[model samples]
Target chain A: MTRASRLYRSSLLVAFAALALTAGCGKKQAAPPPPPPPPPPPPAKPTVTLQAAPTTIEKGGSVTLSWSSTNATALVIQPAIGNVAPEGSTKVSPDATTTYTITATGPGGSIDATASVNVTQPPPPPPPPPQPTLEELFARDVHDAYFDFNKADIREDAKAALSKDADFIKAHAGIKVVIEGHCDERGSTEYNMALGDRRAAAVKKYLSSLGVPADSLTTVSYGKEKPSCTESTEDCWQKNRRGHPVLAK
Target chain B: MIRQPRTPRIALKLHWFFAALLLAASPALAQDWFRTGTGLGVERPRVAVADLVPRAPEATAHGKLFTEVVRGDLDFSGILELVSPSFHPLQSPGMPLQLNYKAWSDAPASAQMVAFGNLQESSSEAAIEAWLYDVRNPSSPPVVAKVYRGAPTDAQIRKFAHQFADEIIGKLSGGLPGVASTQIAFISNRTGSKELWVMDYDGANQHALTALRTISLMPRWSPDTSRIAFACYIQAFGILSPQICMFSLELGRPVTFPRFHGSNSAPAWSPDGSQLMFSSSMSGYPEIYSIDANGSHFKRLTFSAGDSASTSPAWNPKTGQSAAFISDRGGFPQLYLMNSDGTNIRKMDLPDMGYVIDPAWSPNGQLLAFSWRRPNGNFDIYVMDVTSHQIAEITRDAGRNERPSWAPDGRHIVFESTRGGSRQIWVMLADGSHAHALTQSGANESPNWSPR
Candidate 1:
């Protein structure tokens, strides 16, 4: 029975095959079947462009951030500004050197773009200069005048110094100074005392002539007791014989 | 001429003559060193001072002290030459009766005169029997026979020694007295403060005369030696100012003085001690001012204007008619003479140009001794004949010898010198011989001799 069924199936296949061949020969050649449809053009990649207008800004200054994306379904900004619209610009102020990142997400994939803004600060300034004290000012302004040996009279060369001392006394209002007359060690203490008085008086007289009041200037004689310079030389003696002005304590 | 024999008649006559001379004790003789009188012009006497004999065993130390002091005084008498003690006899004379004249008058011990004494002492009192003899003429009476009895302390013993020495010096030198008992007034910082101090002429018995606790300088003894006037830094108008201050040696106290407004210093006393002359800048310039000793009368002597200063006046002790002061009126500090009332001012110019200051009139009113700084030398003490203008430098190459003060004897001078490495009080003969330091403990300056 199996053999008889197999023989009948074979005779049917032969009859259908002969009928398909007789149909292909009777019509024009059928067109080739269309190729399978290509992938929907890869859903255009989500192209992104990010920029910071005024890329360099000072600290505490604002900067504009602009970004554009093609074929992007959602757009977001990082570093404090999240969920932003695509193809739009926004203002951002970064405290310190910062990098702003923009992310775009679409059916194709995700993209990230960054823009860095440099913030600069100026150097600290130096402290203001300290003010000079009153005594210091007086010392800088006042001067001393020297005398010849054994003579208390003002010398021609000492006139300029005495004039400047007078100006200093006059320039400072309400300031008092003591003009100390000094002498060299060549003379006795008693005689030098008198000579020192004369030297100091000479200075006071010059100052008075220059408009400084006598009350504002006092006189003292150190004589040979207080030598400004101590040596046995003539130069040292010249240095010791002077009319020295001191600020009143 | 033949030497006289030791006859009894000649011996009796010489005894009365020598005895009369010993009793006279006359300083009125014309041979005084300070008097500028007619001098004896004799050769300096060669004398020997024997070690005092101690009557008691406990008086041995005091006896030696007395002997040494008498020897020193006689040696310093300026008119006497001392015989070396090495040539003295080994034995001390027990008394005049026991003296060995031949041993003293011999060649090795060639002493024309001899001083011998015995010191007797108890625990608290002492008696000194001193005698000066002419050993060549053994029969002559003693030149000086003195008995001094006092407390047995060192001071009293020293006093007795001075008395005995003075007696011998006066008799032998024909009237010049020894300066052993005089004092020197000066500025000393020995008590941690510059105060007025006084010491014996021989630099003993030093003591302070003030407790001002402030600086005092340039002490000037009054003519009477009873008070001292000096520049003292006293509080005036809330400042330590140099002003004239007085101290009395008798009362041992500070005398009040008028406080001026400016520098007042370097006081000088009149010959009669009636007034004090000083320099004051109260009138805007330093000028001479005269005030009464009682601090009442005030008179300005000098009227130098502008920068001219006249100060440091020394009155003519003999005449009292003129004064010598220092002035810078002619550029340098030079000596100037003026009447007591500030008239007839004249500059004392020298042959050479130099600084002359600290003019001190001599006791004779003939010479002026001052500190002069020559153009080519250091400050030295120079004596000038005021009339002839002849200057003689007494100090040379001795490290700034200055501030010369004539002793009452006028033959010795006391001054400040740096020869010993620091400022010290130094005494020397007026001819700049025999310089000796009187102060070595502290920095001493400006020594003023006492009038006595």
Candidate 2:
């Protein structure tokens, strides 16, 4: 009975195989497949260039730092240049030989460029040309201007002396001078300091009006500390209250 | 100590009787007899400072110094006349238990209050048991009973004595602490440059505070006594720029540079400890300016420009309502007043003393002390009543007196003078009496008394 069943199963399988082959040979294609994507372009390379105008300078001199970058979102300079625009310039006064590096960063990554500034020590300035024997002459030219008791205003007679002094200062434009305001030993030290400052300021104002460079003039108040005369007499006090000029080297 | 050790009942009975006697005597004697020796219509309280009993014989020197300093401090307070040690009873008190209050309150000495202590010194430190007793209240406990220990150097002994004296004053004067323990900050040229220095109220323990080695001047202490602000010349922009700097005692360094654009000088702390008044030339001319404690919120107070300059502002300490400053708007430096906000400017009613400068308002806001120059060019310290404009001279014929600063107690003043052959810092009673040199070696000036 087993042999008879096996032969029947084999005949049915052959009939099903013929039916399946006829159905598959009649199927149709729907559409052609889409083309593959083009290979990705190489990542955009960020570029930067840093340049220093007058790359070599004497000590204490300044240089212009210029930078240009493309395909970058941010730019920065190191060694004190700090953050900078992608395309910009700045003035830098490097005290020493310094290599300034600029880094530009973007989605593509970071690119760096560097420029070095060489600071050369300036040669000694010819020993200052053997400073003239002008101390006594300058002292003679600058006379002490007097003031009244408890008064900071330039006395009427002091204008002549101050005018001559201003002329001398204008004659020697290179010389810097200090006007010391002194007070008689007749007031509080703290108050005298203020008084002294006022006197010196008055002298400075007068000198500036006379064409002396304000920058070349500075004032200090000696108050009652450096009295020209130590006596209690009016004459001594009159002498003590004076605005005297000092030469500043 | 009770001489009879075994008679317990008798001792109790005696104690009760003594207590009863004290309760009866204290009200009348204690109230009316309390005095500051100034004799300014007030009775001088009779107080006695006993020589400190030496627990260690070697500490006798320290004990002597302690007793002397305490006596001197009390005397200088102008509040009490010390009962001389010769007048102290034979049964001297080394401790509160041994205090013979009945004896101290009796006879010619009749000291209402007595200070007694025991001093023991080792090589490095001294242990002190200081006691102050209301001798009039024989049976009452000591008004002040405490132990103080510190280094036993001469300076330490003096400091402890000052503390003890201050304690006594606090107890006797309705809790008003005396200025015995305070310090005076002054400018000195001891190190070849005008620098800041500090000394105890009695002119002891003088020491240099800043080593800036530049021209430092006008040291003024903050109200909290934590910092000393002074004017110093600093090199900025290759030039000597005068700037106000502060030396912090707690930080042991200069905490403030206060670098305004121009010269800054004459720093004075506000009474509330919130701001400082300094003269600045930042506005192209020197004028009074106020800045906060941290050097922010700089506001100019005096608006005078050109030769009409104003500076040296002294803020009122009590109410912080007014300030006294020197201004030359009238062609001469004279005292001027304005509100703390730099408003309500007015001229002070000062006499024709030539020029008035360095106006320091008293702590109580009652008086303003300043240096007034006579026509003879002689500077003397004078005080004027803020309310009545009554002038009182604190120093006369004293070689160039200036920069009078009032102590926190409002009863004393410190100033700089050439009276002692050189410019030295001196402390005196508010009445200009008992002037004593607080600095000796160098030309010290501009004494700023601390608040505490």
Candidate 3:
């Protein structure tokens, strides 16, 4: 036979072989029929509802949770931190003042209400002033700074940290601060280092504005290095990408 | 009695005739025979001359040898733009021979070349003649300057073509040809394994230089064409650790650098080939570090908090006192230049284009070629005049054209692109013309041009 005819025959044979193989395998079973629908019956009734609970309650005090209901079945009370009340009941025990959520359910519908119990601790005697740890005091002279993503300007978070360092330096007139800038693991190393420096410098500028001596603070940038937290989470990254004050001896 | 004598004579004559036929068959039958068709046809008688004349060879342009020899010449010399036979319209099939002087004059091409050849019967052997034309002088007839004769195997054709093109370029440019005869070292993951591969500048004659088992990347060429350094990952204790390795073209063996904790990658060689600059997180962050060629004397160049300082260093050849690096010092990764001592740092004023990295210095130190992330998030190669600070985009529409390396002559740049659905090495004039894919299979990236 000619080459073309042979090829055509071979293809036909292959098709047949494939068909045979498929045929030898059984077909998939059909899905089961869906279940029948249920019949309709009961009528609904109007119900009163509590939108919210008391804004605050005294600490270590028991509070009663209540909600309006409709056609009756039961109500459920869930305390945020403690055990729920009796099945469908609204009373909860108290340890710490916490939020309690009350859900009232009947044949008609369900509704939720929440109440916050304020927990107050008894005033304690005033303690002695905090003595700065050696590391903290050492780092105090170093101006630490953090930056927002792709930014060198000091954010509120960075300012808070810098303010504390500034206060410590003002109290200890003899101490000098070195501002170290840091970055997250989002950019190349070189870019991050410059960014870190910018952060540190921004911190130093902020402190100097607050009457801190400019000559008392120095700035350096360690870009994306020495992360406070190594976990690849936003919270960790935020903490790591911050400037810190290290007291230069 | 007379009839019996006649019969005997006739029988004797018949026997003599048969003997003569057998002798003639013996001379012609000394040949190998094989069936040509299915058993449906009768066998035809034939003679075989197995030992007659030498075997006709398989034809090739001798691409490798051609590229090697041509690249050697260009390296030693300093010419750019090897005029290839394929580029000559007169030599191309179905192309008209009309010479356009204006077009040639406008082109950046330094020379024009022509080659013609015929393949032998076995299709392995070829006889080719080449001609070179000085585009600077369109009035002159083409010069029959050189003749290349060889029966190179099929694999050698591409090298031969490049070599011939380089020769023509040298004659026209008055220096050693640059990219035309050079090869690019790159990483290709076509075989499901990332390995270092070398190909001609135009992306032809691609072959794997490293073994298939390792995941190799960031291939950089030594000033000489003899070796390539790349980053490879080794699996140890259930973790894959990246390490730098050098592969010698001459030995076909890999010499891995010393092991270090964390990732070590982005290797660039000093102009003198004495040290290798790379980014390693060994000091707790990815910082620019240099090590001797034999992988000793590792020294950190930058110390910044957040451990972000320097990466992707392109050492300056002329001064050797400054290097261009990419840093996030501005909160976003941007290109920066710093003294070799990691001081005197300054940001490059790139155009409105942001996110520039991967700086490759031209051999002449007149320009810097780098890849920039475009607004569309696709990377494209761009060149900046060092003195004028003028920037121009070299490639567009080609998807992710990045990791550009300037050819030794500075007239051409080699880079990797994902334009053809798969990443492949591409070469174009430094001004972004004549873009073509050079690799056929596998995704290729991180192309580094050899110096010569």
Could you list the CA RMSD of all candidates, in the order they appear? 13.3, 28.2, 37.8
Write candidate 3's Cα lDDT for A56-174 as tens digits. 44554555555556654655556553333223234444566666666656676766666666666656658887997866655545444556676777788767777877787888786
Higher-TM-score candidate of 1 and 3: 1
Candidate 1, residue A14: lDDT: 74
**Structural similarity to truth (TM-score) of each candidate:** 0.75, 0.72, 0.50
Model 1 chain B poorest 10 in a row by lDDT: B31-40
Segments of candidate 1 deviating more than 4 angstroms: A1-133, A155-157, B1-41, B189-193, B211-214
lDDT of 2 at B123: 96
Candidate 1 lDDT score at position B373: 86
Q: Score the docking of each candidate (DockQ).
A: 0.52, 0.30, 0.05
| Candidate 1 lDDT over residue span A128-215, tens digit each | 7679887988788777889987676778778898788787778888988888889998778888888888888888888888899988
lDDT (CA) per prediction: 0.81, 0.80, 0.60
Under the 3 Å rule for N, CA and C atoms, how many clashes does model 1 have? Answer: 0
- Sorted on DockQ, best first, the list reads 1, 2, 3
Query: Per-model TM-score of chain A alone?
Result: 0.57, 0.47, 0.44
Each prediction's fraction of true contacts recovered: 0.80, 0.54, 0.11
Query: Which portions of model 3 show Cα errors greater than 4 Å?
Result: A1-249, B1-144, B147-151, B212-214, B235-239, B374-377
